[model samples]
Target: MKPLYNFILSAIGATLLSGCASSPDHATAGHDAAAIMPASGGPLLPLPGESLVPAHDPDDGLFMDALSSWLEQNNAPPNTQYEFTRIDLDNDGRREGLVLMQSPHQAWCMEYGCSLFLFRAHDDGFSYLSEISPVRGPLVVAESQTSGWRDLIIHVSGRQNNDARNVALKFNGRGYPSQPASAPGLAMNMLDVTGVKIFP
Candidate 1:
């Protein structure tokens, strides 16, 4: 009886120690997940009135209503199609905004193809930057390490049949892309000039 009691106590002690050891690991795993998950259920921008062909059919009326309310409040103007492509460009957990507009002047340039606009959610509100025209399949952000600085790269492509072009826009301390020192030496490509700092 005495030996049996000792064995039971030993087993209980081992279980407790194992649980203590795993507690920290479990906590750390949770922290990592939280850091990677985008913020959900925030106040989204309102949808415009003329009604958008829902990115998904059988639209959720509640979402549409909230979107409509946002559009009216922001005065987004007529004939602008706002598409929220939830992409986390900056890796900030919160998804950034991708707006596609089909204005007559702008629309004509694309010839009915969609124009891509990226917006970063700022403390005050959403800030719209340049129209991203890809030289390849799609314009994507690339980062690289140079001699003594890091570069924020943007690739812009021309029309469908054109070879994919490259534009290396550098960024500095505050995280904005710097202007190209010289011409990209490529024709029919747009460079980022949004005053984003560029590192040498």
Candidate 2:
């Protein structure tokens, strides 16, 4: 709860200072285009959506390790800010973790978007499970399942995509697609925004 409060304040400050402008041709909600939605009557595990950090960090600095590795690879500093969320991606009792590594220097993002990682919990702690590169939010944990895992509705844009889109990333046994722009499209009738947005 403390982490969530801090994250909200940070997000508000960032948005006010940066304006968080959108691309000129990016699709707006006015389009009413086809996009991801929860499967009919799928059970939802209620959780906070607008938090910038997890209520509790994964044990043993599992998340920080992954962030440090990514920052080192990109030559970004370890102090970069990020957004985090937890969801029951497998419809299991335990929730998995989602981290969006953000930096003022654009270290983690490409033209497409920033890198988003999903961590699976283990008895020892949390372990690296899968990654979705170049992603933006607010992301959705959909009720729809693939390979026994919930699908992710991610905001995608940039070079590969002429206009921005909400792409559905399904777990393919191994993991979700690293590149969301190349994923399959959903029809336009997913009007109801079923799941909560994961980050601010």
Candidate 3:
């Protein structure tokens, strides 16, 4: 009987210690240095149908869900980080989605550098239009519509090799590889060009 009692007491003590260890610390629980406890925030309420919501707001659960679905569909390799930039590429008073994927140190060598993907949201869902390669640092996209078709102009640069770099100016439409132009020179390395016109 004595042995059983000791074992029971030890098990109880272990359970108590584990519970306390899993709980968040007071500092992390939003308590200040003065030890004043914080109040419980209000509950979250869903927006009504047809409510006006900003597209880029992270708090919007619908937008977050859609973005997550897109990311998962792309199947980004492990250790790759993506930065999304929103711009009005079409200049139609609506913002377009531009995603820049970079590999910090991944097994895929081609993904180690930079890649750009352009997307536009529609009534059904977002549509992926084109993808460009050798896109290094920051990216800026602008729209140039001529005749009855829309053209997306993308500017990207990256270190091609030791002591040598490359910058490419490409365009895509409903059809891809329609417009291709490139310039390479040692002095032009890393220099930002205002805009390069792509001829189809």
Candidate 4:
């Protein structure tokens, strides 16, 4: 319980800092957008309307209505329980919506993991961008090999004898990679320390 509480606090802190202009500027200046490959290499889907981020107002009926409508439109289960925060994932001066939801599959029991969803903000509402199941760590937006946008980083560790691994989901101009690689972007630089403890 303490660990979970700590994680929540850490996530909230990171998210709040995301909105501030004083946050670390990791952008690689003078980098050309053309250098980075487009995301997924698939057709970029356009939003149907002005999909903006829903306000964090629980008591407002209209807010609930819009939230429900967005959830239904995105095929989320009606009974799903989730909490969300807004963060500028790409450092593009726009905040992306991040939602942590309880997974339906209880069999995949995890002490500090949950389902994560990333939503792109628009004028009308937020649109579902990507999802990562069993996210064991806070979602961090960082600079990647791509010049145009920041990448999404998640750390996951569940099985025994394995240290937590950081997975970077780089954004292609359109969206993030549908299937991320085991070691995304400069993971080769990371030394393999599986089953080896440095701080014994």
Candidate 5:
């Protein structure tokens, strides 16, 4: 399983071949600090249907089924197929699901980004937590926790020469919000697979 997981990470990283030519300088500011503004340029173009939101609940213990249903409800591209994984992100004695789906719009994929969905473990079922579109890096579960739930960190590379950065989303009882004010944790280089931390 470790080999398979690493392969997935490598595949996802490869998608960044057409990403920003250079990585941005990592910020040393506070967690709540605002990201560095984009470089000067012409007026921004309108981004139609850029945001994606979960429209329905996921089936219990079924990754593919839930993903298919979600795509239909959201009217995603007909030919879209996703890669997914289920892990106990929070070490809560249950597993949570993560899905990565690429968009059909090449123009919007300047960073080789994809739509990311996080699912919360329910009673034998999974519930939609939140969605983030155009996420550029591997979705990693942090070694830190907030309010008992582990933090989920994602990297966002620059689009059209914009700066690349990572953001952490902390669970808020319901789902991890789009932009969390502050999360004091570092991103792990690999996914958490140890089953020793399971909650009793």
Candidate 6:
């Protein structure tokens, strides 16, 4: 309730007590992107056992199960083809999964764009994180972080692929914005980012 001197003192105390703080749940103890990046940092890299082979693997029980659920929930065709990209967003050993349905029947896509699904890796399999829809690619992974997660920059094509605008989706301790049009507008040159192709 104190928004002045007490806040300043609290901030100072926070800095001092940061070392003793615990990491975000289901995430990290303390993960710095620099700590995981290669000496000569290049693009985002997937940590060990985090790569998605064949992009869409039918044998991947976890992924298949999640996709099925998503499709059923949306009343989409169960056989909708999808492409996936795996990258370590939180600098954790496990890479987060980004998926886009792009094939035969694009029931999930609209005039604005297609939907993207986010998932986190677990020892058992991929767990659903969130669903960001009506966004187009190429998506960019930003150097900036929020709530210990990397920010996302994606193209949001206004009606009929016209009036296009790129938006920034910062993780709000739980997930990114489900509707990107309401998210903050982002200029291409405003931040350091790695452009990623998720639809190809």
Please report, in order, the local distance difference test score of every candidate based on alpha carbons. 0.31, 0.51, 0.34, 0.41, 0.42, 0.52
Q: Any idea what lDDT model 4 has?
A: 0.41
RMSD score of candidate 3 (Å): 18.8
Better of 4 and 5 by lDDT: 5
Global CA lDDT computed for model 1: 0.31
Candidates 4 and 6: which is better by lDDT? 6
Distance from true position, residue 193, model 6, in Å? 2.5
- Superposing all C-alpha atoms, what RMSD in Å does each candidate have to the true structure? 22.8, 13.7, 18.8, 16.2, 18.0, 15.9
Per-candidate TM vs. native?
A: 0.34, 0.61, 0.45, 0.50, 0.52, 0.60
Query: Model 1 segments beyond 4 Å from truth?
Result: 1-77, 103-115, 122-125, 129-137, 143-164, 168-200
TM-score of candidate 6 to 2 decimals: 0.60
RMSD to native, candidate 4? 16.2
Worst 10 residues of 3 by lDDT: 1-10
The best-first sequence of candidates by lDDT reads 6, 2, 5, 4, 3, 1
Residues 125-147, model 2: lDDT tens digits: 45456778878766777767889
Worst 10 residues of 2 by lDDT: 1-10
Of models 4 and 5, which has the larger TM-score? 5
Instruction: Tell me the tens digit of each residue's lDDT in model 5 across 71-111.
Output: 44455544443444455556544556665554354522334
* Ten-residue stretch with the least lDDT total in model 4: 1-10
lDDT of 1 by residue, 84-190 (tens): 33333453333344433333335312532444444443322344333443212233334343332333344444435663455554433333342222215333233
Query: Compared with the true structure, what per-residue lDDT tens digits does model 6 show for residues 7-69?
Result: 000001111111111111111111232211111111223343544433332122343344344
- The number of the candidate with the highest lDDT is 6
Q: Which regions of candidate 4 are displaced past 4 Å?
A: 1-67, 103-112, 143-147, 159-163, 178-181, 184-200
| Residue 155 displacement (Å), model 4 | 0.9
